[model samples]
Target: MTKAHHIIIVGGGAAGLELATKLGNKLGKKKLAEITLIDSSRTHIWKPLLHEVAAGTLDSSEDQLEYLAQAQWNNFRYRLGRVIGLDRESKELLLEPTLNDEGEEIIPERRFSYDTLVFAVGSLSNDFGIPGVKDHCLFLDSTEQAERFQKNLLNRMLKAHSQSKPIEQGQLHVAIVGAGATGVELAAQLHHVTRLVSAYGLDSIDPAEDIKLHVIEAGPHILPALPQRLSDAAMRELHRLGVTVHLNQRVVEINAAGIVAASGVIIPAAIKVWAAGIKAPEFLKDIAGLETNRINQLVVKRNLQSTRDESIFAIGDCAACPMDDQGNNVPPRAQAAHQQAMTLSRTLVRRLKGEPPLDYTYRDFGSLVAMGHYTTVGNLMGGLAGSMMVSGYIARFVYLTLYKMHQAALYGWPRAILISLLHFLRKGIDPQVKLH
Candidate 1:
């Protein structure tokens, strides 16, 4: 009998989970390959929705998919463990022992041999070693972080509302230290949701009067990666929503009270959110002498295979793949990850059939910025014959379709349609923002 081919995937994120589902349905069902997905968490949530989760605009419990349930339904095996190291020579992945909240070992440290290994561990916030940042500032990199911010926000609002005296200084001040997509969206969403929260009988504290939002960026402008016109439109909308935009102001320190700019000026804030940049996990940098970029993304070839070992493949935010057009590198975005995942699915299938995997190319699908109910602005590339700028409700619709597209990729047409309908139906019954 032929030995069963084993494929080990580390990280059940957007890219990893999708790839696993596709492969499991295609290969695992036929017994052509054994597919296993390893992740630290038992649930999976798209990382892009983290901003919405952070602002309490989206309840995570309703949307989060259980990894175990998904794996069982999709014909894949799920292992709960953190990958600590890789043994390229031995073709084994070293999984660290998993512990429960009570400090008891849940899963023992073990090694999993694999014919092919794919790393899709994703990226995390890069604090850049700023003073007091790790302890004082919140990051929206994980579900826990976003939920923590949401809980803190609700508690702050409730405390202020219950106060017998007038609102004190710095009552609900939020300082977001980045004008990137995540920070900007969070700022706008907070403005819209906080007002909605106030309407639900948090009457003593007025959302507009008591809550203040400060968006700080070291760059000269917000949405620096987007076109100037779209960025300008976003700036205008943010200003209309009473968000203070601070440009060219680098945050040198994050204290318990607020953030201190490099210029020595201190901005008083009750909460601070850091969303400036991202870097692959530090562990990947020295992982078995693999070639990595400055941000610790594994250097992969055009075929998405690691430079050190072709058996090892990397994708999503963890891989540094070259851009064909500019000779630069692919940008880490949800779309890029989705595209790479699709490409790798086909490539892996071909490889299983004793065929060479094809090189992966990233296609630019343009970008969109959603600013809650205020507006959405974006440029449409690969849409018309040329690029076109879109704004307002139309842009908002397009922006939402992006998330739907992700759902379609993962769950197919029927499930995606049902999920979308369920979300819409829940909107009528639930408050727009989670007040508690």
Candidate 2:
């Protein structure tokens, strides 16, 4: 039999998994193409929810999707390994050997040939060469990191509650750098979770008094990328929740004890989180001679094809795609990634029939920052009606629908509804927050 057209997608992130599922359903199900997805990890979790995972508001163990099971159901093959090298000339990519916790190799180094390749390898927190930040600060880029933060948070809380001594200045203080959506929402979530923790038998530690959440932002306003109106609203909510917001404070260094600001301000913190900025992985820079941007993102054309090679395409945060002619690129957001996945799925299907590709256009549904169960705030961009600021239950409902939409895209509406129900049922029996 003639060999099927092999399509390989690297990175089992929001964009990569969605694209893989769609293409697998359209082509792989019919044996028209062989679909394979490669990732360093075996499970996938929505990137935006990492904050909740870190704060213990969301249990990642129940939410994370197993790539192997997903691949089996979606008619795609899942390979667990990191892409270390790419050879455009040979139409092949090399994966490093997969290793276990003890450093024993599981899968040997392998190379896979692809007739078409798509890169959706997401971005990571960029420290910008900040001194001691990497060594002292925790990041919420992955589930592993989030879980680590959660465990550390629980242990610290337990220790604080068990001790008869007074809480030290930095004992229960959490210093979060960057007041973007992640930092702001995390501050709010952690604040709410602290109250829950205190209520759940940790009464010795006062949520408002002992659990201090500090947000340090170099920008003049929180959520600098967002409108000033939304940022102001979020700030008000955060302040009401007793989160200390330090604006225009540039962090010069981070140490085991705390963060030092350029303005001679030092914030003592037992746990520090860095959510300052993001950049595509360093390895993507000019990989296989592909054009890359300053942030190491693959420079892709309007149709999402690499500038240097047509057979290779990139989407999601890894692809520096143009938004318009004004020298602007699409922002790295979940909505942008979702749109790219939808557009790329169509483009690939059309390519099978020798048809022209479809271009990806970002749709601004606005941004929502969910602050645990306290409240959700955001701006709603209605194309013709203009932007409207929303908060409270309406905004919370909209914020939740975004996640529901993602679930529907993956499992269809029925299964997504069932999954939602299962989560609801699980919440009744399980603690609101992860205890151990």
Q: Give the Cα lDDT of each candidate.
A: 0.90, 0.92
| Model 1 steric clash pairs | none
* Count of backbone clashes, every candidate in sequence: 0, 0
Top TM-score hit? 2
RMSD of 1: 1.3
The deviation in Å at residue 404 for candidate 1 is 1.4
- TM-score of each predicted structure versus truth: 0.97, 0.98
Could you give candidate 2's per-residue lDDT for residues 319-419 as a string of tens digits? 99999999899999998898999999999999999998898888899999997788898999987879999999999989989888888888889999999
Query: TM-score of predicted model 2?
Result: 0.98
